[model samples]
Target: MSEITPADFALFLLASGDMQPRKRARDQQADLAGLELKRHVLDLIVSYAPPADALEATLMQIAQEIGPPYGPTRALCASIRDEFADAASTPGFMEWLIEEAVRENAGQKEKRRGKTFNQ
Candidate 1:
C-alpha cells in the first residue's frame, strides 16, 4: 500500500463530515451510511497510526467545530493521534483504506448521475 500522507488524512477528515442540503430520503440514508463508514475508517486509521502534536491539535480544533451529535469530539481526536503506530505496523491496512476511499468516491459519483434515455 502507498503511504498515507498528512494531506490525505486531512482531506478524508474534511470530506467525511460533508453534508449536502436538500437530499432525498434515500439519499439521506446513503449519506448517513457513508458518513458512518468514513467515521469507522477514521477510527481505524487513528488506532493504527496516531497523529503528531500539531496534527492532533488541528484535528481537535476541527472536531470542536464539528461538535456533538454526529460529530467527533476533541477527546476522540486525541485518542486517534495517540495511537497511530498500530496502523503503521499493520499489513494491508493502508491499502484497505485507499480502496475504501476509491469505492466511496465511485459510489458518490453514481449517486450524482442524472437519468437518461437511449436514443
Candidate 2:
C-alpha cells in the first residue's frame, strides 16, 4: 500500500476506465459503500508524479474534468458503485490493481504505438 503512489493510482484509474469523465455521478450516488480501501489507495497516489506519456495525460485530464475536480478516486468509487451497486463486495479488486502496478513497473505490458514516417 505504501509503495503505491498517485501516479500509479492514476494509471490504474486510466487503465481500468473507472474514472471516465463521461459517466454521470448521480447514477452512482445511491450505492457509494465499501469504498474505504479505494479511498485509502487513492490518497496515496495524490503526491505521485505520473509518467510523461499520453495515457498519464489522458487520466489527468479526466480527473480534472470530473465533478469533484482531480478526484480520480471519487470517480472510481462512483463507477464501482454504479457497476457493483447490487453486489456487496468483490474480492481481488485491489489485488488486480497491484498486478497492474507490477506489470507497469516491470514494463511487461505492450508498448504504445507512436507516429510512423514513410521511408
Candidate 3:
C-alpha cells in the first residue's frame, strides 16, 4: 500500500470516529456480534436518512462505535439530542425530520444519478 498522508488520515478518523480505536484496542476480544448489530442499526438509519441526512448517517455510525449506552460518545450523542429536542416544542422529533429530509434529498439525488440507493 502507498503511504497515507496526514490529511487522508485525518479524514479517515473524522469518518470512522471511534471505530478504529475500539477495534484496535481489543482486536481479540472485540464484540463481532455487537459490531454486526451496530452496522445493521447504522444501515437502518441510513435507509432513513436519504440525501441531506448524511449527517444523521454520520451520527448513528459514530454513536454505535462510541459503544452502546454507557460510553462517552453515546453520552455525547444523547446530550446533543437533548439540546436539539429542547430547541423544539414537541420534544425530540429531530430524528423524524432528519429522515424526511433524507428521503427528499435522496429522491433528488437518485433522479440525478438515474439510480436507486447509495450510488
Could you tell me which 10 consecutive residues in candidate 2 have the lowest summed lDDT?
110-119
If ranked by lDDT, best first, what sequence of candidates would result?
A: 1, 2, 3
Model 2 stretches with alpha carbons more than 4 Å out: 1-77, 80-88, 108-119
Better-scoring candidate (TM-score), 2 or 3: 2
Segments of candidate 1 deviating more than 4 angstroms: 1-3, 13-53, 60-72, 82-84, 114-119
Better of 1 and 2 by lDDT: 1
State in Å the error of residue 84, model 1. Answer: 4.2
Q: What order do you get sorting by TM-score, best first?
A: 1, 2, 3
C-alpha local distance difference test of each model: 0.53, 0.44, 0.44
Clashing pairs in 3: 50-102
Going through the candidates in order, what is the number of backbone clashes in each?
6, 2, 1
Clashing pairs in 2: 5-45, 6-45
Q: Mind giving the per-residue lDDT tens digits that candidate 1 earns over 22-54?
A: 456554765565556447546544543444435
Pick the lDDT winner. Answer: 1
* Candidate 1 TM-score, C-alpha based: 0.46
User: Lowest summed-lDDT stretch of 10 residues in model 3?
Assistant: 5-14
Highest TM-score model number: 1
